[model samples]
Structures are given as C-alpha cells and as structure tokens.
Target: MPEFDLIVIGGGVSGITAAAYARRAGRNVVLLEAGDRLGGCCHTWHPVADFWLELGAHTAYNSYGALLALNPDTAFGNLIPRAKVGYHFLKAGKPQSPFGRVGFLEAALTLPFGLGKDKAGLDVETWFTRLLGRGNWQRLLAPAFAAVLSQAAGPYPAEWLFKRKQRIKAAPRKFTHAGGLQGWLTELATGLDVRLGQPVQTLSMADEGVRIVLAEGELSAREVVIAAPLDVAAGLLEHIVPELACRLRATVMAEIETHAVVVPAGKVKLPPVAGLIGGDDAYFSAVSRDYLAHPDWRGFAFHFKPGLLDGDARRRKMAAVLGCEPADFAYETAKTNRLPALTPASVALARELRSALADTPVRLVGNYLNGLSLGDAAVYAAQGG
Candidate 1:
C-alpha cells in the first residue's frame, strides 16, 4: 500500500480544507506547502498595534457553509449595511461619491437594467452592458468587477454572473474575523500533517500510486489532490498528466498587486463607505480599509492592474487616488497571480479537462477548477472535486 491514502499539495484554504475532510473520513493524509506558512491568499499583516490589515481575502458571507464548518468557533463581524453605504470615485483627481448629483442622474438612468433577469449565452461584459446599460457598465460595473475579480473583465460567461447575483442576494450578512482569516486558517490546519517549505519538484503516476518528488525527498500516495494554482499545477503535472497540464496551461492567469497603507485617521477624510471604484483606465477600481474594527487608524488597501510597477510609480498613483502626498502614507505591498480569466472558451476548456480527470486518482481543487471565493473552494474541496 502507498504511504498515505492521499497527499494534498498546496496549503491554501482549499488544500487545508481537503486535508481536514479527508482526515475526518479516516484517510491518512499529508498536506505540503511551498511557503513557510499556510493561508495562501488569505494573508493578514499587522503594521501597527490593534490594526490587522488583510493583504488577501478579507471578508466572507454568512452563506459560506464550508468555511464555517471547518472552524465552528470563529466569531464573525458584520459589514456596514447596503442602504447606508457609500463609496468614493476618483473624478479629476478628486474623490467624489457616486451618489452625488451628476453621478445620481447617471445611476438613475442605468442602474435599473442591472436588476433585470439574466439572459443565456451572453458574455459578462455584454450581459452587464445590456442589463445595466452602457453608462452603468462603464462607470460602475467595470471598475467594481475589476476590484472584485482582481483583473480586467473579459468575455466571462454570463452564467457565472447569474450565479454570483444569486449568491450576493442570498448573502445579506458579510462577516470577517477579529484576527482576520489567518486565525480561522490556523484553526483548520490544526492536527493535519502539514509540511511547509517542501515544494514538490515533479509528479508522476506509476502502477503503485501517484509519485510526488519534493526537494527533500520523494513521497507516494494512493491519491493526489492538486490544490495549487493552475500554472504551478501545470508545471508539476507536465510529466505525469501531460494532457491535463496542457489544458491548465491554456487558461489565462492574472497577477494582482495589493498595497496596504496606514494613515492618521484625522488626516484622511473618507466618506462613510466600504470602497471606491476608479473611472476610465485607472490603475485601481477600489481603495478602502477596515473601518468597522479600527476607527482610530485609517488602513487603506488598493488592488492594482496586472503586471508590475516600480515603487515610485505605485506611490504616485496611490497618492493621486487618496488625495495625499506620497510621503505621508506608510504602506506595504504584496503580489499574487492565481486569478484566472474565466472567458467562455477558458470555462469550456476547464469543464472538458475536469471531465477528463474524473476517472483518474488525481483530483484538482482550487479557484481555477471551482469558483473564486473562499466558500466556493472550500465546498468544492470537501466534495473532492
């Protein structure tokens, strides 16, 4: 028999959850992470006392059943209500509310269409344009989605949007932990045989089982779960599963840079809002911070367009959006590249690849195969998808 019933690669939310569930099922499982820590994209940083700035995913809906299941003792705090909420938009280098007079008129003329029923076989850009009108699509939909997806919108399937709409409407209460997502991840990782900093160099499937070659040593398992990003998975599976690797390579991935800065609460005058979306070809769609928990210090976090930018250029752009001098802000930045472009063709190819891998011992999990949310990944991993 193989050394373990299953070997799960990557220690992100999905991989952690999968290992936990496998343990619950009485399977001998081991999780491997390339980094020194777990919680791949759900990372938190503390630059100051009593201030936890999340560099990755910060919020979760009440409907995230899988996440809740893993850490039942977690305490979640709710976000500001929708009706009372407002966000800033950069207009002529100034931060203005979208609910202002000129913005209100534009919204009045365009917002109604977004509430209408979904249409079949439409791409995301086209569907939103048709449903919410061109004005709303440009001013609201484009930037808002750019922030959410961490990339510019392309020909994504409208079906995904429809499901997203339902999830949004159903999840009225958005929640976050006091210690951020890292606390919850730590709880989920407890007792699991996790090996950090042991990046798998290659993988092969033999008659005995799936062979995983790591920098330290080689390990074999009866089953393998690749919970890593698509690109990383493609490289690892190149020798064993060439067809699957080829398909994974075909999917486009977007890199996103996030900057978290702390500013004196008195110096920054932000509206009572959660976030702001940028207009035109702005580098960022949203710039905001955790206001509910830390009211004393204004912690600003912004997502950047794909590709790298020098420190000086990033500082200038952020200063422009916040209406503050670059010298005034103390900030830290992190870059990640797992957000897949879910265009129609890519979605079709993913589906085809998934179907092809169903019979094999190697199972795929993560935002690429499943949906992009922590909840989606957790549920999919639990189901062994």
Candidate 2:
C-alpha cells in the first residue's frame, strides 16, 4: 500500500496549498522542502528581533480567493492592512509620479481600436502596444510593467498578466502578515505535514502508486504533486512523462538580482512611498516598506537585471537611491529570484499540460501555470493543477 495518499514535492505556496487541499479532503499527505524554511520566493529577512524586510514577494491581495478561503480567519480579519502609498518613477535622482510619464493624447487616440483585441496568443509588448500607442507603452507602461514583474515583461503573456477574479469584500484589498509574507504562508500550512531540508531527487510511477526518491530514502504515495520551479519540475517529470518533460525543459527562466537594505528612518531623505519604478536604469524596481511604517527603520528592495553590477556597486547604487550612504544601512541582504521566462506560447503550453495531466495521478502547479502573483499559485493549486 502507498505510504501516503498524496506527496507534494515542494513546500512553497504551491506545494503547501496542494498539501493543505489533500489534508482537507482527509488524505494522508506530506510536503517536502529542500530549504530549511518554507515560502520559496516569499522570503522575509529580519535583521533585528522586531524588524523584517521582504527580499522576495512584498504584497498580497484579497482577490487571492484560494489563499483566503484556506486562511485561518477565512476573512481578512487578522491580516495587517497595508497603508496607502503610491508607486513612483525616478528621474535625475528625483522622484516623479507615474502619471507624469503617460502619453494621454496617444492613449485616447489608440485605446478605442485596441479594446476588442484578444489577449490569447499575444505577448505583453504586442498586446499593450496595440491597446495603447507605442509612445504610451514606451514612455510609461513598459518600465512600470517591468518593475511589477521584475523582468523585461515584454515577452510575458498578456492573458497571464492580470487574471480577473472576484474579491472578498470583508477583507482588506491589500495586506501582509505581522511576521511577513513567509510567516503568513507558514500559517496557511499550519496543520499540514511539511518537511524542511528535504529535497526530492526523482519521481517514477510505481505499480500501485508514484514512488518519490530522495538522497536519504524513498516515499510512496497514490498521487504526486510537483510544485517546484520550472526547471526542477521538468527534471522530476523526466522519467514518467518524457514528452511533457521535454516541453517544460524548453522553457527559459528569468532571474532578478535583488538587494535589500534597511536604514534608520531619519537617514533616508526621500519621503515614504510604496516603491520606485526603474525606467531605463540599471534596475527594474525598488520596493519600500513605507506602506507599513517602521518606527525606527525603513527598508527597500531593489530588483536589478542580472550581470549589470557587482556587490559594491549595487550597494552604492542602493544608497544613492535611498538618499543615504552605505554607512547608513543598519541591515542588508541579497538573493536571486527566478521566475519562468514565459512567452505568449506559454499560455497555450500551460493549458495543454493541464489537459494532458487531467486523468493522471501526477499534478503540477506554480506561478508559471497562471500569473506570477501569490494569488495565482494558490488559485491554480486549489484547482488541483
């Protein structure tokens, strides 16, 4: 007999949600995480006992129905609401509102003809350029979208960009947990079996179920859910499903070199705002902790395109943007965040994979399937994909 009813090969939001769903259905399930902690891209760095900085994903929305449905409160009762702030762009080392860059006349002229265009099989650059004039796309939308995605954003699928979903009115529209996003996700995995520092090696279909291989030993489950990164998922599926594996392996991954710093509140000369969008600059975006004020400190995470700067240069650039020197930083941290480098073709690929795996015991879920938002992973996972 299988040792478990279900085995989730990953412990991020995707994996945890899968495990949670299995457990709720009264199945025996286990979650394996290679890292010491959960929350793959939702990393929160704490320099001191009370303060924390988001090194990865920074915000959550009420539209994340799958997550909220499984939430402890089931309503956003306990969630910490984010304070109001505006996202701005910087020019000549000064801050400017995002609207300042919009080409209103161009937008008015092109929007009418662009409204009825289908998003399917179209990239963000192509879709948006048609929807808004080239001037508006170049002047405002391009960089702003890049900042939100932490990558070029041009090749990303237009359909996967902003997935429409209903909201929970009682909950705050935008919020985070007291401990951080990581901690919030941890709470979501509260009753599930999550094993940290456990990396899966390979997956094979057993006579009765799926057999999972690890460096330490092996485990068996009637069903298997792969919620790992795009490349890692491809590797796991290599033996059991070669064709699907090949398709997934062909996908490229994008990297964001993120550097975050926390300084005394008084040290940062720039007034508190949500974050800054990098236009043609070295970085893509810089997120601030201004939405949730810290009495003694403030934090910022700058996501840069890889290969542009080394360690020292990155720190100097961050300091310059923060209106302070490196010496003013009380705490600092860095990490590389990777997401599927998707194209318009990916949307079709995701649908094809979903249809192919529908009748099988194997399952896959992650940001790559839908959108890159925290809600996206939860929704896809909740749907058993």
Candidate 3:
C-alpha cells in the first residue's frame, strides 16, 4: 500500500489540476486515472490524422486566468478570432439564412416568448433582452449560448443567463491551443506522482486518515480530495461522507451531448467561418476547420440544445443537419460523453456540496462544479482555494 498526503480521483481536468496544486503546495500527492490515457473527456484521439482531434472542448477563452497561469506562455498559441456567425434554417426544403447571428438574437427578444426589448424599468433579463434585442437572441446569442452550454434556452432561469453574460463578457471570442489542451494537461502533470490506469472504486475514513480502494489495490492518504464527477464521487464517498454524498446526489448536472466527425480537410466543404449552426433545432450543428491550430482537418460537430438531453431524440434531430444517416453519426466516438450543464438549481447544489466539504479538506472541482469552461477549471485549481 502506498501512502500519500492527498489523492485525486479522476484524471479529467479538475483532478489533474487539483493534483498539480497539491504538488505545488509541496504535499505528497498521488493522481489516479481509470482509463489507460489521461485527459479524460479532453482526450483527443485522431487516428487518421496526425494531430490531436479535439473530441471535447475546442477553445479556452482568454478570461481563463488559471489555465493561462498554468502555462505562462499561453499554451493556446495564436487565437483565431470569431469571424462570422450565422444560422441555417430549412425553408422550402432548402437551407436558408433566416437570420444573421446578431440579427436572429435581436429578433428573438422582440417575440412574445422572448426577452422583450423594453429597457425602461427593466430587470437584468429585460435589460439584456433590450441590449441584445430579439434578433440577436434568436440568431447569435441564443445559438452561441446553446453551443457553449449544449442545451436550449428557457430551461435555465433568466438570472443564470445574466450571470453568464457578466462572467464571460470580457472573454476572447474563442482560442485553441497550438498543440491542443491535452499537451498542456500533460505538461501540468510533470514532476507530480500520477498513477495512470488506476480508478478509485471505494473509500473509507479513520482517525489516522482516509483509506482509498483503487482497482489495483488499497492506499491511505492523510487527506482526500475528490475531483471527479459529482455522481462518481458520490458513490466513492457514500460511506466516507454520507452527508456530502446525499447532497451531491440531489444536484442536477446538465447533460450536453456532442458528436465529432473528423474528415480530411480537403474533403470537407466549409463556409467562411469555423463554427456554423444549421436550423432552429434548438442546437448548433456545423463543421469546425483549423481545429488544432492548423488550417487542415475539419471536424463536424453536433451539439444538443440547452435542456435537450434526449440522447435518442438529439441524435435523430442531428441527422437532418448533418445530411447523414443518424446511425452513422451516433455518439460512439470516444464513447458517449455528456457535457455538464449548470442551471441555477444545479449551481446552488454545487455551492452546497462545496460548503459541506470545505472544512474536511475534500476539494471538488470540474466543469459541472465551476463554470462551463476548461480554462475556468484550471484557474480555479491554480488559485488553490
């Protein structure tokens, strides 16, 4: 049995970042991953291509101070600013531009169902609606938010939307790492003791410390920090921390499902922009070009709308946008990964979970717990709070 001061479960961004922080604190740390490879969902496996095929997040905004701090050189490299955003709506059996990115959003606000454009005595949403207008909401803001969050609007409270605008308003349009974020995670793990292919199955606590049972064997740690998924961590800590487990189980993690189709750059027929959306299917579907900071290898991605977590329904819906058999476009690639969507309720639950574990030295971190950005997670872990 190996002994350490801290053990971080799950090799995803949060766990990796947590381990890095523990090591920086000069504490004995051991990191464990279930899969043979690290990066978890961020793992980009491109067989036909030479470079990393981003199966998960493509861009980390400039606002992600923690991510940037980990790589003082800005591992994201040169940024390709957002060029033009548009929506493809099917009218008369043809893809027609119903609205430009900004126009659609502005229009959406004016509609009765939308956040109207009345600014006087307006609250946060009304003010935002007036600022964006109906067209922008329908076209740009709505779709863009959907793309980032992986769910359609309306399911989340209006306040949630307002908070997000405030959080990322100053962020860059979008940026990708020169070598991909996986490289950065790899580099971050350096000099730290990481146990790869060892998934934490169970945990127990005693007066001395905590006992962790991994797939390989058992080990003890003076302090334990669970940085895996809430549900996953819940199961592991059910006996160790029943109160925290119950609290975590009560929370809802938004499920954002996306499928990536990697085609040869030469074979891909692309528009002028990198990210494109087709139709009002409550989601964004388009081909991604220059994904790996290279001008080749376009990846066509389909993301479900906000609150649209119907795995079967979403796949069926994407068939029309993708112009391919729905079965072929199934989310079998890199297994099925569900992006964590944070609603106000979920957000509150996360806060409660954090508070419960605050005193005992169990730190929770992830896209679900934090904001929906990889850079944010990195920054949160780097701050070491």
Q: Best by TM-score, which number? A: 2
The CA lDDT at 164 in model 3 is 34
- The residue-level lDDT of candidate 1 at 146 comes to 71
- Model 1 lDDT per residue over 196-269, tens place: 99898888886777988898789999999989987888887787668868877878787776767777666565
Point out the higher-scoring one by TM-score: 1 or 3. Answer: 1
Model 2, CA-based lDDT: 0.90
State in Å the error of residue 176, model 1.
Answer: 1.2
Model 1 misplaced regions, further than 4 Å: 74-86, 92-121, 162-172, 307-309
Give lDDT tens digits, candidate 3, residues 143-208.
555555555543444443423322333334555544455655776677878778787888877556
TM-score between model 3 and native:
0.74
TM-score of 2: 0.98
Lowest lDDT 10-residue stretch of candidate 3:
160-169
Screening candidate 1 with a backbone cut-off below 3 angstroms (N, C-alpha, C), the clashing residue pairs are 113-131
lDDT string for model 2 (177-248, tens) is: 987999999999998888998899999888788998998999999999999998999999887678988998
Candidate number that wins on lDDT, 1 or 2: 2
